[model samples]
Target: MDQNEIQFSYRARDDRGVFEVVPRVDGTPLTDLIDKFETDAGMRPSGDAYGGLVPQFFRFGPMEDHFHGRLGDAKTPLLGCECGEWGCWPLLARITTTDDLVIWDAFEQPHRPARDYTGFGPFRFDRHRYDDALGKLSRAVDEGS
Candidate 1:
């Protein structure tokens, strides 16, 4: 570990390896953990990787089903919203291993050791950060070729 590469931390549901075997938090063994995390956090997964588990956290009996902003404009980045609502949202992570997790923000900025998010959970990750991370991953994959 370099003295400079900060340890970005967050409290994810730790579903990195159960994609093919484990059942979801509910009886539905088919729910995608990612989608569950997003829906529960009141956000949307930025990828086409949802649809199966997009309803467990939703589908309540019409309490004015409000729609949070979607990731509009494929060419643009949708970082945190202008709304000030906060909660225990899940932090999306690109984990290298069980002990090596990186929580990225929409701007591609990782958590700093000196970060003072004293009220938020381990961290609060959103879509824009995921897009930035996807960009980084694409670059790495391209370079490896």
Candidate 2:
């Protein structure tokens, strides 16, 4: 491995072969991989794909259920909400294998290792977070135009 390169391995649910989460210096491999599964052609497989999972990072608390319902309807997983887009909610990640074993919040920004979060799941949402998420989701679902 190049001294500058970092990688992690997980078994994929699809024929994509053994999944290795790698952050490329030239671009974002994780995002690209997610995009493939999230596309219409791939049909967005369940488990760890973008739409397959719920948003764990939120500000003020977890969003409400209606938000989640809308989230379930969302085509893209890990979407950046108003809070997330502005960098209020920390970006987190969870890694899992076919056996259901998980490495919670395992990813980090290739450049910013000091930050508490970097990428998507192992989801670790607390009660307060969930409540807040549900509230936000409700607003998003009900109030969103």
Candidate 3:
């Protein structure tokens, strides 16, 4: 989802360099980022949808658990709600450090002209573990069949 006014890149490992928890001011709104996370990445909310758990553009715990269970490793850079709740709150996240830090970028609602928030280092993950998980995620996104 490349736009003339915005640029997007991500590094799931330590070398990816996600040091700060600030919004990218390249003229792209937060909702567009979340849309990429959902449409391009295929990350969806994983609870009972009829129970008020709709598919979220950015879901932390479920994505973490999915990768963790498959890889049998615990190192990941992406972190989510500390209280373990799921919703379309986080717009995007990046691993700041190898395994003990991440910057969670979020928005109050998935709309423009809305309040936004940033969280620094909420979840921890190992670099290699993150790599493995990312590989799987990328494959899932690329090979949707």
Candidate 4:
């Protein structure tokens, strides 16, 4: 598998008996990856962040201008607070798309600008495959609802 390849899977959870679907990337929980990055960088990992892959807010497109936004730019929220609120703790990244590829880079921890995420990712994915993965996830979520 290519290092830049992106894949998505769900990590089901029982939150006080209420089932929740958290997304996983390349078979590893998204939050775990963030934690690992922090640890590797000699920083204490905050184990409270959670993946927030809600279809509406996370679909492949330009995000609503928030922390780092321009009038009609693209950005995506990858993770949110464990308390289930996205704005409280978000791990955002700029998503740039081309004819045959989708690139995720310029990561930011909105609330902690001082913390650098320079080496975390610049994950690139083939556009067709990326769309397929997201489409599958959307269908699964719709079916479950």
Top candidate when judged by TM-score against the true structure: 4
Q: Cα lDDT of model 1 overall?
A: 0.25
Query: Top lDDT: which candidate number?
Result: 4
lDDT of 2 by residue, 18-50 (tens): 221222212344445444433533332322332
* Candidate 3 lDDT, 1-145, residue by residue in tens: 2212211122222332221111222454333444453444333542221111111323333433433333243332222222222232323233244353222333233322233333221333444645554555445433432
Say which prediction, candidate 2 or candidate 4, comes out ahead on lDDT: 4
- TM-score on alpha carbons, each prediction: 0.18, 0.23, 0.27, 0.75
The lDDT per prediction is 0.25, 0.31, 0.31, 0.61
* Model 2: ten consecutive residues of lowest lDDT: 1-10
Clashing pairs in 4: none
lDDT of 3 at 70: 31
- How would you order the candidates by lDDT, starting with the best? 4, 3, 2, 1
Candidate 4 per-residue lDDT over residues 1-145, each given as its tens digit: 2435555554444553322335455666667888788777776546655555443433333222221234354566767766545677877888776678777688888788888999987777777877777676556666655
Model 1 Cα lDDT, one tens digit per residue, 26-116: 2232124334444554443322232221112323221111111122211111111112111112222221212233232232112222322
Model 3 bad stretches (over 4 Å): 1-90, 99-121
